[model samples]
Target chain A: MQYENPKIPEGINVTKVHPLKTFAILVSGLLVMLLVGAWLLGFGGGYLASKIPYSQEQRIADSYEGDAGLEQTELLRYLQALADKLSQQMNLEDGMDITIHYVDEGVDNAFATIGGHIFLYRGLLEKLPHENALAMLVAHEIAHVKHRDPIVSIGRGAAISVGMKLLLGDASPSLLGNAGLLTQMRFGRDMETKADQAGLVAVNTIYGGVTGALALFEILDGIEDNGLVKSPEFLSTHPASENRLDELREIANRNGWSMDNTPVPFPEFFNRSLLLR
Target chain B: MIFQILLILVLLILGYFVGSHLEKKHYQSIIKREEMLRDIPAVASKILPPGSENFNQVLVMGNVTISVDYFKRFLAALHNFFGGRVTSYESLLDRARREAILRMKEEAAVLKATLVLNIKYETASIYKGGGKAIGSVEVLAYGTAMIPKASIDAV
Candidate 1:
């Protein structure tokens, strides 16, 4: 029998490989790289986010261009004056100006944003029984700004987004461009608890007691019990009202602060008819 | 986080095993078919055998498309990061080419062709949707199949 093999065709390069071995090598290499990339992004991004400057945070917040509803109204002026009075008790960073905006909507929500902008909805404002409770509410939101919670949240979100794009190729532009929507903003549980304690201190300093803070909790507890608020503990961005009240009571008792002081009357410009169903 | 990594590793391993088995089976089938079509010679020249003026010539073609598994795709993506030869994709293209040629030879054999002449091949990458990454490769093999005059006359 003739024992000559056919010559391989010209211009064709062939590489013989053990299929299973090659597959194993490829899979292991990919897994290792992915794991290392995720780890680097997690720790590296967190460190980098904390070092962003206040000016950069303000720029990011300005990019949102939120609705300027009722910016020059008398009620808005009253609210801003009250917020300014409460903010005096907070230790704000330099160049950080807190601007209060009043939204004449029927939604029951208040939120603090990156550029020291606090949005107060008419629905929540109308429910306040007195001016002290309103001051407590404003103090809580101011505390969020004082702690730079919004900037921190935005930094973490941006870091994760950039990391994902780097790892998974280019993401859709629409998803990347959607940086607005204050309702979608979230802060960690620890930040919320810190805001609560700091807000209690601010209210105590302004009203000479914790009566407004406790009354604020009582109002929230009543609203929560009426099933008007559906935010469960896990789904809520804020801590549970009951737990926050207990913590407020503990802090007030430990500091020998009275919780039974009379709440001041609402200002003349504050319209109470909006609360009527 | 550890669980996420473990899950990804498990998926990769599964893809590797399944893809390896499929490739091995396909290779075995290709070898068997190559042996069966060996006697029908294929050449890259238009010249016919001497004294075969009465032979009939017709074009025969075969096309094949092969895709890589998820493991190989992940490997190639990693290779892209480092800018190296993507060896994982090479095998996929090679298989497509060989399979196309073999299928062309099988088509020529069906016509009782003594030989296939002026064989040519073309290849193109097929992408899924609008993404940048290649999903598969299509290889087309074409040749002129020649039937001997005497065999046709006898039939």
Candidate 2:
């Protein structure tokens, strides 16, 4: 009797399908599901979040004590005063508080947060060419507060994260909670565009021209070209300065607001106060 | 968020290309070795061949440990989610089993055995990086080899 182990054919136990075929199908399907789910959740969340009353949102924001002991400095008072005047020009509704927080650090960034709090850094402030441009900057942040973008962004993040956790487990960090909400509020592109328009309109009303508004974008673009604000987080939030400049011109043309004016110079104490602690 | 997504993309692409290349190379080597060692037959039967009294018996064994690439592991995880045949792991186990058997057969050939019988396989999983990081699968093959007893020299 002959005993032999004949050569078995290949692909007997293993599937002959190319690994990438299955991978492509699986990965693409997952991406589509994630994208669709994220979009729906983001829309639903933004809508629901926007529905939240300003007063209640303020209560939620008050839960954080990050600024509990921060005192009002000369810079803070000036920014607050600028923000208040810009808020009036923007026709902010009654009881809509726009608070300004001035940070002495030279990090080139200015952003709004929940409860109408806007934080401005000295690095970005020092670059402002005039008071009108400052009004434009403050108006932009005030516009964010007026639109309640911070809470909406938080709501969008929370909803998406909940969905992701259910589908993909804990693969990503949850974008909810106080620290994430405060430090990492990423407003949508449309939010920035709308805020830009609102800000341009308000500055035009206050300064009788969009001259300083254009200067604000020029200074921001110069900073970008100088490679000063290299943080991806900061870059990702604000719209491109060139695009904003074109849009500002277009907005001026359509609204018949003057594109050129003698821009109001900064206050006598502006340069000195920005350098103070 | 963008950075995280980019990182996952980079890992997936690297895993796929490198993993497929290595797997193909391994299969080629396994097939070539299997063909070379086919002269020594290893069977899973318990009964000894007739005239075994004129033969020597010895234990022949082989062991192999193999790991799945990150791409295959990720695919398997996806399979776990959808509940289907884990095709990615099939190739990994197949390679390990064949390699183990081939090593056992090579040992049998070295012992100058005519046949190997009662062959059995043991399989286990080992985690290398951590308790949760599944690292590799180990396959051990063992058998009894029958060699010529040199009875003709007894005269």
Candidate 3:
């Protein structure tokens, strides 16, 4: 087969491009590249992040040395037993172990990081009235661990920071260092919703009911209404307590799970605030 | 997130329109001056035109530095990724070159010179903020101005 070159038309000024047309084409092309790059980074990064190994996640989690905490006490033992009970009910993957940490901080918060490490603040622990509500909180954090959310979050954070640096040419050390926290705080609503659902399921399996999940959210909702916590729901990493309660109700209704189980009393050691410290 | 993206887009559009407007105005001024100085030719030649040897030669020079606007810098960064002709920067250098030549002509005019010969342009990049960003480009246009001794004598 012969390939023939096309002949150019005579008197055609092909080199001259309309300025407006050129501007439009260039700008649109740039916008397309930016949008496509963003989409690819978001979706591709999320997909890759979800597949990171549990061992590597543990390494990442180990790097974060949290503040000193009280050694193994009765409350710590009871909390550990409760976490073990919830762990038995969860659909956890192999090689994943839940290690509960008792921090002496007065902050009202409980968080699960990259590994199976769960940090329960004394302030949040002091607020719990029953074992079931505490179980719900523990199960929720475990759900985050089972889903490898911390690792995925870190991955997405690093991806976004790198993308920003490439696009903006401003890669300050502080920006890179705070990438994990930024992504964690902006945890997609879908992830929060998923954790809530999984947590309810785990709670139901362990206690044969879902009241603990509802009760936990109701307490949080009450605390929020009192303005004891200054952080607004809009800025929080987790969904609002009321929204989570609604979602828990929907899940319970869908599963036909009971929401009126007997409340398990808190352990005797939990009653003493000094012992908690 | 949407607001941030919108802000960037607004900045790019503003840069394009404003930068293009400034460039067009400069081009207009340059064309007008070029027309006015048509008779007083500037060339990169060693020999002068076939005129009687009755002219004074003096060194004349003009230096100009112009900064790239935000939009052009943004465009250049984008071009860096795709590896193509950076048209925005092309126009920027073009404006600088013409402005430098025009200034050199003005200098010759001040010296009562009718023609400038052996015109040369030296360009350099000036970086700022610890070499983080390109601050501006300096273009130095120099030439030997030939003052027809008659024009000086008249003066």
- Maximum-lDDT candidate: 2
Candidate 3: regions farther than 4 A off:
A1-70, A91-95, A154-188, A223-236, A273-276, B1-78, B82-95, B107-155
Model 1, span A162-245: residue lDDT tens: 777876688545432544436546787788889888888888887788887788878878777877567889887677889889
Off by over 4 Å in 1: A1-50, A59-66, A172-184, A222-235, A272-277, B1-155
- Candidate 3: which pairs clash? none
- Local error of candidate 2 at residue A54 (angstroms): 0.9
Name the docking class for model 1.
incorrect
Cα lDDT of model 2 by residue, B4-76, tens digit = 8898788888888998899899999999998888778888999877787888889999999998888888898
| Model 3 agreement with the true structure over A78-195: per-residue lDDT tens digits | 8888888888789688879888888777777888776788888877777877878899899988988888776677667667767978878876566335345423534567777787
Q: How well is each residue in B1-155 modelled by candidate 3, as lDDT tens digits?
A: 68989998898788778977887787788777767665667778877667628888999988899988777787667667677676667766777887898899899999988788899999998885685575689999999998888888998
Which residue segments of model 2 deviate by more than 4 Å? A2-6, A17-43, A63-82, A160-181, A228-235, A267-277, B1-33, B36-75, B82-85, B100-130, B133-155
| Reference-based lDDT, each prediction | 0.77, 0.85, 0.76
What tens-digit string does per-residue lDDT give for candidate 2 at A1-277?
2588898889899887877888788878878878998999988998999999998888887764357335866666777888888998888878788877777788989998988888888899899988988899889999999988998998888888888788767845646567787776999878999999999989988889999888999998888888955555445767778877888799899989997799999888889887655
Model 2: DockQ score? 0.53
RMSD of each: 9.1, 5.5, 9.1
Best by DockQ: 2
Model 1 chain A — which ten-residue stretch has the worst lDDT? A1-10
lDDT of 3: 0.76
